[model samples]
Target: MRIYLDNAATTPLNREVFLAMEPYFFENFGNPSSAHHHGRGAKVAIAQARGIIADLLNASPDNIVFTSGGSEADNTAILSGIRSNGIKLAITSAFEHHAVLHTLQALEKNGEIRIVYLQHDAQGNLSLPHLEKLLSTNERAFVSVMHGNNEIGNLNDIEAIAQVCKRYQAVFHSDTVQSMGQYRYDTRRLNADFLVGSAHKFHGPKGIGFLYRNAGQALYPLIYGGAQEQKQRAGTENVTGIVGLAKALEISYRNQEVTRQHLLRLKERLIFKLRDRIADVDFNGNSANTGQSLNSVLSVSVPDPNTGISLISYLDQHQISVSGGSACNSHSGAASHVLSALDTPFGRATVRFSFSRYNTAEEIDYAVEKLAKCYAKPGVSAYAEGLLL
Candidate 1:
């Protein structure tokens, strides 16, 4: 039985999304910028897709700007928000993905942006008091925090944070890539200046995502070229990818409750099975406060350090796909910054099993069974000790 438990990394493209994108690749291959019939048809499709995305986020189509993916969307928001507003201080958490972390680091090194790192509590929630203190010190700042952490699946109090930003008159941006399809976000209610999401994370095709910029907030374009994306972003659009994203978003929104409940059930089942069958296993994220998190991701750590990598390998060998950390940082063999920020034991064995609507209870059972066997292997404990030594 093959089980895919890495939906947080990327989900398989839904058939509906694929079908929606089919005609764009061959039948309607006109640039949206063209005024001809073919161009007009493509433009209509693009507009419709934008409308669909807008409806999903409860925003006007004019507020959405498509990009290559979440990384580009993040870069655009961070660079543009700071540059346009001339805000020297950027407040973000140390747990952010490399996309945000590295971007802020580069800007700081260049003396283009000053950054303040927000502290995370033991549960991975942002420390509001710390954030308020930082904001009080620097009145002119842009705060960027993620909606849901990709590794641990910890959800931040974005609404509260937005209120803090409002009090401080700072621009607030959120990387909602992980929570876009999983959670309900009404842009009007969230009150964030900028939000970013990637298509691939929501069972859509790769190479496309969008940044929702609230009206009246200007951002400098990272990619300068032909006027595309209403001058806020440039370069030719990914027609097929955009269509796929819209279809995916439509499905997600239409079936949000059903999918959310299904994923939560699977997550609970998996956690129960792990706890009932395995020893020395601890859940890493705020499982008790799941209402604030994406119920699909379950980050767990084994007390035995050596078993971490071996367990991942064993799961792979058993055709049960999981993640040691974010796929972007998996190759580096580094401990997760998210976990580290929460003061989770570093250099310990950890695995994140993220679910999707398509996952089933049977698959969870099989994964737990395989994990139990792997953890019980002879010398596995010794191997774990060696790593610490």
Candidate 2:
């Protein structure tokens, strides 16, 4: 079986979620906006799913607005939060997901708002003091920071950052796409104005996600021409996907502790195996620091840039799958913006192996074994000799 270690990109849909979504596909398929019985049934299903999600998040049902996925939710939060609030200044980190960075950059280009990127240390940890300093000087700025780094697995102290934003009266939005299913977030206590989740990231169906806009926060619709999402978003809801997302999130929260423990074991095993088997292997960002990183992700850096470039394809040949960093950057082969922001060494190759509850210790060992072979000295392995055809 192929060792699938790219859960950060997406996860296999859970059987339970699939089953919960089955009826919605055909049996109950109807436009949620319709006024007939079929429409009411579909609308009720959406409401129940919304309630399940909101309750799980300890948030009010009205605060949750469903979108196509995390990208859409992120776009809605940044654009609406900034525009509706009339915020002219913004702060974000250099390594935020493109959804946030690019959107803000577009606004900056249009001269709608000026943005300041918060600096970070060599470890990829954002400087909260600098964030506070910027917020203090700016006039009611919008701040977008993520709870977890999708590429490097650095977990930011968003709660503390939220407090700082509160002190400066700045609107804070955190892209929690990577952190959502794995961690418990009580929106009532999070102190942020906006947060995002993508169903596909946590074993739910793709094409669905939710945006949590705290009570009293003003955000205009990202989509127009319909009353869906209480008019916060417009379109016919994806009933099947919505049902699956709710089911998937429920399963994730129910098994979160068990899943976390299992993933931690797998991650630690891989980290130990990689360090012991490779000569010049290291890690990027805070990925290797369990206390400060996502438990499911480990970003390994090999000394040889050539190996870094070829290791993934070599592993693929051996029935192992991994990534250089974010799947969004996998095709480009460009150095990850996250790693670049940290000034990672120029000659090293970085591989990100993300874990899930489905992963096993054997798969971890197998992946590392093949990984070490890829690093073999020049004549010892074909890949090491730059001989792969």
Candidate 3:
């Protein structure tokens, strides 16, 4: 049986989500921007989906803007939030998803703002003191931080971070793509100016995501043409995808507690089994603790960099699907900047095993068992160890 544990990358579409979206594919197909009976049906579906999501996050429907995916949502939140406020500086953590990091970098490259990277601890925590220093030392600042590190699964204290931003009077944005389904978020309680999410991250269809822009934040559009998303995102809305997204969010939240417990146990099982089966095994960030990190993700650093094929490739050969890093950087031909920035041993191989609600304890065992065989191969572990010294 194939064991797929890369939910951090993307999840399989829930059957319920598909059924919710099925009618929009052909029967009620219409462009939301058009003004006709067909178009009215599509528009209502999109509005209902947006309202459902807004209710879940405790935000007004007008505050949520649909985007192509997390990248666009993040870019919209960061760039627009920065420029809208005439911000001169941007601050972010070293472990943010490229969607946030790269957007900050591009803005810096264009001389729009100076970028400050907050200090990150070995446990994958961002230093609030460093953030305070940067904020106090700078002008109006735009800060972007992710709720969870995609690679290491470190959960940042967003509420604390939001408080700091409020104290500094800085604009704050968080990429909640990884944590939205796993944790509960109340925009009223958390005062972040912007929050972003991708539907695919939570078993919804891909190519659909949302950016929650705080109700009084006057932000401009990234895509401008016709009036859609309140003229904030100018493109025909993905009606089917939006409906799927709402249904997926509903299903995830319905079982969030039960799924959380199940995934946590699976993570702990892998942690102990890896230590028992492999020498010098390590878990990145605070992912070893379910309470501290994302319960679904465990960044496993092993001693083997098997020749001929990668550790991920070896696991794939054994019908276990995993990833070396974020799927976004899968084809970037670059090492994980998150791990590298943390001064990780250059020789070790890191595999991100992100679980879903569907993953079972038996599947976890099978992955670890297959991993043992991969390490048993000639020159795998020894090679990784020899280079460590």
Candidate 4:
């Protein structure tokens, strides 16, 4: 039996979401921009979907601008939110996803703005006091902070961060891609200038997401051409994907409590079993802290730094799929920047096992059994230790 514990990378398409999107792919298909009967129907579907999503987040439909995915939404929020406001300074943490981190780096490379990286502890908790200090010290700045760490599963206190930014009168943007469907977000109460969501992260269709631009943000278009997305994003609307996204988010909210309990149980079970079965097993960041981190994600560390990739390969061979870090950087063949930034110990190998509603207790037990066996093998642990000596 193949067990997939990589929900953080992307989830399988939800059945209900697929059904909602089916009509758009066939009989009801039409370009939403057109004015004929066929086009009007498609346009209605898109608008309804937008309304559903907006209602769920307590955001205005006009504020939700569709994008290709989280990366695009992040880029849009960072570049447009910065340039359109005439801001020249930014603040973020090293734990941010590449989407936000790389975008700020590029801006700095072009001599467009200065970036102030907020201090973080080894457990990946960012300093909010430091954030306040930075904001007070700098001019009006664009602040990009993620709602959750994709690799370490650290949940940043974005609400607190948003409050600080508001006090400083700075623009705040959060990459909520990981925590979108998992957590409840009322944009009005949160008072963030921008927030982003990706459908694939929440069992919706891939290649579809949205940017929540607060009213009167005056953000310009990242893509230019058509009048789609209320002249903010310029491309033909992704009607099918939009329908899927709305349906998926609706289902997520309707069943949010049950899903939360299920995921938390699975995460706790995996943590307990791994600790009981493996010697010196540890968790990175606040992932082990149920109260602070994402219940869907857990980053496990074993006492063998050299075995990060090797252990992932072993698990794959045993029909258990997991990841050493973010799937986005898996092919880079370099150490995880998040782990590196935290100065993760040299003798520990890390693996991120993310859960979904589909994962079962039996699968958790099976994965732990395989991991225990891998460590039990002669020279598997000893060999790595020998190399360190």
Would you list the clashing residue pairs of candidate 4? Answer: none
The candidate scoring highest on TM-score is 2
For model 2, what is the error of residue 251's alpha carbon versus the real structure, in angstroms, after optimal superposition? Answer: 0.8
User: In candidate 3, how many Å is residue 152 off?
Assistant: 0.4
The sequence of per-residue lDDT tens digits that candidate 3 reaches over residues 195-276 is: 9889999999999998998986876788988888887888788899889988998888999999999988999999999988
Q: Write the per-residue lDDT of candidate 2 for residues 26-61, one digit (tens) a residue.
A: 899989999999999999999999999999999999
Q: lDDT per model, in order? A: 0.85, 0.89, 0.87, 0.90
As for TM-score, the candidate ahead, 1 or 3, is 3
Give residue 59's lDDT in candidate 2 (0 to 100). 94
Error of 4 at 296 (Å): 0.3
- Tens-place lDDT digits, model 4, residues 41-155: 9999999999999999899999888899999999999998889999999999998999999999999999999999989888988899899888887789899999988898999
Model 4 reaches what TM-score against the true structure?
0.96
RMSD of 4: 2.7
Candidate structures ordered by TM-score, highest first = 2, 4, 3, 1
Highest lDDT model number = 4
Q: What lDDT is reached at residue 156 by model 4? A: 91
Each candidate's number of clashing pairs is 1, 0, 0, 0
Ranking by lDDT: 4, 2, 3, 1
